[model samples]
Target: MTTQANVDTRISEPDAAQISEFLRDHPDFFDTHQDLLAELRLPHSSGKAVSLIERQVQVLREQNETLKSRLLELVNVARENDRLSGRMHQMTLDLLAASSLVGMLDALEDHLRNEFKADVIALHLPGLSETQLHESGAENLVVNETLKELLPTPLCEGKPQCGRLKQQQLDFLFKDQAAAIESTAVIPIGHHGQGGLLAIGSREVNRFNPCMGTLFLSHLGELLSRMLQKHTAG
Candidate 1:
């Protein structure tokens, strides 16, 4: 009772599910017919059709390039860190060789200016004798009890702070050069904020930020504090 037209209408194309099932069950089919990988084309983002193998090769090449770029970046970072470490060590040695507090401060300022690229370096030490201050040219030494109050509470707690300071605070530290400062890193020296602070200021706004790492600066502060204490004790 089936006519030729009815027979033609009854035939159906394979659905996506059937094709997927067949491919899943015959996983080795592509291995056996490797030419099919080259024959099958996928639409690329560039509106060009690329063979499956070509697409896979392109993806691998891109990943390889990314890895290479990342590796180079790491290498550059390591080299930079090594250079900075060398400079820091050399600065420490110079500080140790310094006989007087002025010599130590001069060394610190010189290294910070030449190596660290700081625009201004100031150490505000409290309780230093007038004679010592004048002899050392330590104009930044406040020697007053209110110096700690000039800094924020967090920094007063003996923490390193980095960011833009208020105009008044900048003036308190840098004086006339305060107008030129855009950013700063304030490293607290001594235990319980007794000794004083080391201020590093820059003309660039982005030179120091709140999120910058303080580990190295903190270690430098401690080292300088011990040196100061020893000098003062003598």
Candidate 2:
């Protein structure tokens, strides 16, 4: 038989799991036992004892700091998005004001080089020979049957593609500038790819990658196709 002293000691020293489960079940227990909160101590990383209230305050402070950091990051992203939108709006306005295909191409090239930071800009319009485009004052324009085969399935479906290009594709698109280009964004203009395809090449190998966002590229292609249609109608 256990003595009264043993019974008292057993009641005071409950199993760890029992205490943990009890606390987990009764989260507000400390709220009711306000004095016990101040009495409880936790081992500090500095090998010193800290009051439970102090430890809780430290944890809350750390959480607050983390939240502030994330908020700042979100704010920076929003500002950057706003800046990009402003530039894209300006570019659209410039494109809309173009009176001819030459003007349109000039606006496209200028905005892409200055705003989008493309190192090399090349265009391939099918069915139109280089001589025909050159006669129309578009000497930089090109045409190649291999361009159709080089386009990825996404581009065939009228979507933009971003990533490193094969040497053959780069050579066909950039031509003389192929030696300098390391990556490229290939954007197919028009729904059926009749308008043409635009290639924006970069010297940075990782600048255009498969993971990059293509929303801007898609919108740019649509705008270009519409502009080309106007030029053709004129």
Candidate number with greatest lDDT: 1
lDDT of 2 by residue, 1-234 (tens): 999999999889979899999999999999899999878899998999999989989999999999999999999988988988999999999989988777888898999999989998988764555654784433243333454566754345667878888888788778888999988998878874567778899999999999977888888888988888887663
User: Each model's C-alpha lDDT?
Assistant: 0.83, 0.81
> Model 2 TM-score?
0.75
TM-score of each: 0.76, 0.75
Instruction: Report how far off residue 121 is in candidate 1 (Å).
Output: 1.2
**Which digits, one per residue and each the tens of the lDDT, describe model 1 over residues 1-234?**
999887777665677898899989998888999988978999998999999888989999999999999999999988987998899999999999999887888888899999999998777777788888787655545534476577754245778889998898899878788899999998878764467778899999999999877877888888888989878785
lDDT score, residue 132, model 2? 48
How many residue pairs clash in each candidate at the backbone level? 0, 0
C-alpha RMSD values across all candidates: 6.4, 5.0
